[model samples]
Target: MDFLHSSWLIGLAIFVVVFVLAQSMFFLVKAIQRAKVLKFQTSDIKRVMVSTMIFSIAPSVAILLGLLALSKVLGVIIPWIRLSVLGAVTYELPATINVVEGVFGQSIGQRITDPVLFVTVVWVMTLGVLPPMIIIPLFLKRIQGRVKNIRKKDQRWGEIFMNAMFLGMISAFLGYVIAPRTDAVTGESYVSLLAIFTLLTSAGLMAIIGVIITKFNKEWLKNYAVSFSMLGAMALAILYAMLGVR
Candidate 1:
């Protein structure tokens, strides 16, 4: 929404619409795709979705608590600390927009007058409601079929779970601080459509690990998963942060 760029309200409007669609649309499609590909049952995904949502959301909780905790405690250590650097994803929306326009205004609009809409549209395509709308379900389906029956002896699966959760939390935390945001004159403060893409990009690492867990030995993926996710997420956050969103 061009209206969102000029104001936070409009961005909220776009976010509301996009959020509902993203959470639901991809839930089923991803489930179906993963089930078919993995030869699992579509109906079984109900539990998978529930489980993944629970596991993935944990980091979000941690992020919130971490921010509050960090603010009160760490703020004492580094008196100049600002929320964005140490806060959750939602807090950084304004910074994301401001940095993008201030830093890349010319090149962004060089080819067109409505660079706002141009970026919004492209971002939605690349990062909007598409990835989760297509991935979460697949991931859940994999969890349902391949991971359900593993016993404690399967330390391999345990390591895989730990790795996936670690990466998911890191992404979620950064996403809170640096997610795409837009506001409009209509009084809506919203995250951008690009959030979907960012989520997808971050989730890709988890997806890959999940696949490996299902077909390969966990020890290999485990030893390398955290290091890889850390580097990848850092690069992604910097790239997007510099990209500065509309």
Candidate 2:
């Protein structure tokens, strides 16, 4: 039996995907019903749903790109299940690489052949990300309650705290993009100029979109502004690469 294309694995993936879709539909219906009960206009609910769906496209495409890379190494079923569940490519790629190189002394460029090695990689990937799953289930309610208490005590401070957290995360990624690197042979300082360019381009495009939406009152553009900016930035990155920016 070919583990990579096993019938059972494909069936499992299909089942999981179907379950996820069903869960999403269930929640969406419930939310719409509750919104109606709260006297929300039907048009407002539809607009919210449409905007949310548009906002999700770019990120979902990014995930699909990750799935394509993972599929080359681990085959389709495993990556399909992982990405459909809690596994983002950020975590999944590193976990797979770490186990493949550290434990098996193999490269991910090659297909995983041995069942034992494959199983070990799967176990490592699963265990590495399992802590968050456990923690969320056990502590999420308490954490939410504490956050609510803080907000109740000082609403302004609570908003500031959340903004700070978001800024910290963004700063970390920005730092990574601009961090210095040395050429392997030339000993010259290098940085990911393409990444910086892409980041700035995306930011500029988003800012422009915000200005246009505010100044001209282009309300419909708000639904797709982020997606447009992201794709535009990605295209600029490719152009930057072609022009030897990095």
Candidate 3:
């Protein structure tokens, strides 16, 4: 565990961070140059950039929450680097849990002390994302072309196909959240009320936000709706724990 936060790990994380920042800056400069060549107004560009930075806050907060949750078991450095880089909480948390609990037969809440187990997790997390990176670049255009062709043939079916895909992805996580877990000590299975309530809280918050956006015409709320729902649901989970709901 000491090595998890060692100076070498910190240094590697810093290098990755710097490289990502430099890459972003390179793209930003190129974008600005292209905008200037296209005769876009400087003020318009500035406003767009400002709005983008402001809109990024909502997702950033969600990432921060993910980092905090993962840090409890994995420590801060790994979660910080993972969340900062090409990983989302949805993927990272599950990947970690699957390795820690499923593969290693260990508790999720306990800190991982075995070096081999830690490396196995790091490799899994790193390699799991590579396929998407490779597949998207190699086949995304072909996939999109097929989707466009399908839409031209029957727009309703195209929409349904896309929605179905999205729902299928979501159902995997939903099942995990609602599934009954057996207590280790008691050898009994029980549904997690906390998970069910948290799920409902987030869904309800999102529903309320959607209604407000549609009825009140608060178009700007779209940017923060997911963040608000996630944060609100997390807060409720904390409150539930404090109130002994579990």
For residue 78, what is the lDDT in candidate 1?
18
Cα lDDT tens digits for candidate 1, 1-246: 332234454454456556666877888787678788997765455546665554455465556564454333222211112221232334333333343455445332223235564345334323433556567766978765665556365878877887897999987776685564556566666765455545566568767876787788674455445445544654576677678742
Deviation in angstroms for 23 in model 1? Answer: 40
TM-score of each: 0.26, 0.87, 0.62
Off by over 4 Å in 3: 1-8, 22-83, 88-129, 184-187
Q: In lDDT terms, how accurate is model 2?
A: 0.89
The alpha-carbon lDDT assigned to residue 83 of candidate 2 equals 92
Task: Judging by lDDT, tell me the better candidate of 1 and 3.
Answer: 3
Give per-residue CA lDDT, model 3, range 141-239, as digits (tens): 999999999999999999999999999999999999989999889989999899999999999999999999999999767766777788789889999
Q: Model 2, 1-246: lDDT tens per residue?
A: 789879998998999999999999999999999999999999888878887787788789889999999988898789889899878999998988988887788988977878888888788888887887789999999999999998999999999989998999999988998998888789999887888899999999999999999999998788778878988998989999999998
Q: How close is candidate 1 to the true structure, as a TM-score?
A: 0.26
Model 2: weakest 10-residue lDDT segment is 49-58
Q: Report every candidate's CA lDDT.
A: 0.51, 0.89, 0.88
Alpha carbon deviation, residue 70, candidate 1 (Å): 8.5
